[model samples]
Target: MPLFSNVPALRLTLAYAFHDPSSLLPHQTIPTLLSLPLPLGPSLPSLDGTGRKPTIRALVLDKDNTLCPPETAKLHQAYINKIEKVKECTEFSHSAHSILIVSNTAGSSPAPEHEAEAKQLELELGLPVLRQHPDRKKPFCGPDILKYFKDHGVTDNPREIVVVGDRLATDVLLAREMGSWSIWCRNGWRNPAMPGRDYRGFFSKTESRFERIMTRGFGNTAPLPKAT
Candidate 1:
């Protein structure tokens, strides 16, 4: 099984989260990513105190809970509606190139079934899925993700991308690792119509609670990227 695929990343993320909980904090928190304004623009508040909006050329979205229910491939109707609204309301368009889904279970696991799941998600969701990577999962997969976007002709600059997900440790940390911005989905998809659990387990819930408690009082701002 690929369950162990995230063990290494998890260890590192835990240490990082404890040492710098603010780094795992979200720039903005919403019920779900679907609520984020489409075609995010400079009118949005600056991530830092500099008052300069970061460019948004592409988006990296998490699948489980963030877009759909945890451990499921089905896209919620709310998100589907939101995507259609985005296409109609703005020039910004979503395709396999402009928007991508990054999921630890569907794509980044080590098992072959995970690869098949990724392909299935691509076909069902109408967006590209990052292919399975044995060692590159979230936080650690930022470089691979950047290369994927670059090769696909999306923006090459990581600063131009925004990573949206429900998990602070993986999703938020991934953005920090990639030098991109982050949007945290605090509640995930909570619609009663959607079936299945939102969080993976008690560990997921406890860690998130801990991170929230630790990050309290810190402003909602993206931390400066480390020097290359």
Candidate 2:
């Protein structure tokens, strides 16, 4: 009974598609892959358009929820180690240019504060940060963002990209649109209605269906996200 799905046209698509997280939060949502031209994975989707498993290439990470809490000025100390370990994880180890932060800083108070924040984060992580100006923020994948990726040299194949974030409407949906993979971090912005979190009372048909889709069938491997 979530507010977004009351529309009659969406019920059937909600039933068969759109799944829950079977693996640990932020590991990677498998059901998001159902729309892919090929099958879902035990291995990664081929990025070269050759139907072979591709090594992880570029990562477009969300900042606020996935790496740190929202609206904070500094990088949370608790997540510093967790972020470092991402390089050590089985999938990633790309060159410095390959890892990018694609977070929204449009709403930051005092306007340019987000730029300073991005610089500070870049210094802390030793990685390039791409904090979008509010004018071209997330859920949009504006020309600037895509142009940055192109300028920095991502694979021509979009499937090689991986998006990690807390919101489905932004992070996951953006990746889906790009034909890339997505991971939903249950750790972000703490919404009761987020994919895996449970809420009270008789759930609406939409909410129940959403939970059912996102909670099951993933294989666990991702580390528990440490909080700030």
Top-TM-score structure, candidate number: 1
Please write out the lDDT profile of model 1 over residues 3-108, one tens digit for every residue.
Answer: 2446876777777766766777766666676687766655345745678776677888888777777777776667787765654533246334767789887887
Candidate 2 on 32-130: residue-level lDDT in tens? 111112222334434344676544566777776456545554554445655676655544464666677777662322357777777778888877777
Q: Compute the lDDT of residue 213 as modeled in candidate 2.
A: 51
The deviation in Å at residue 225 for candidate 1 is 4.3
Off by over 4 Å in 1: 1-5, 42-48, 86-96, 109-112, 192-200, 215-221, 225-228
The alpha-carbon deviation from the true structure for residue 148 of candidate 1, after best TM-score superposition, in angstroms, is: 1.2
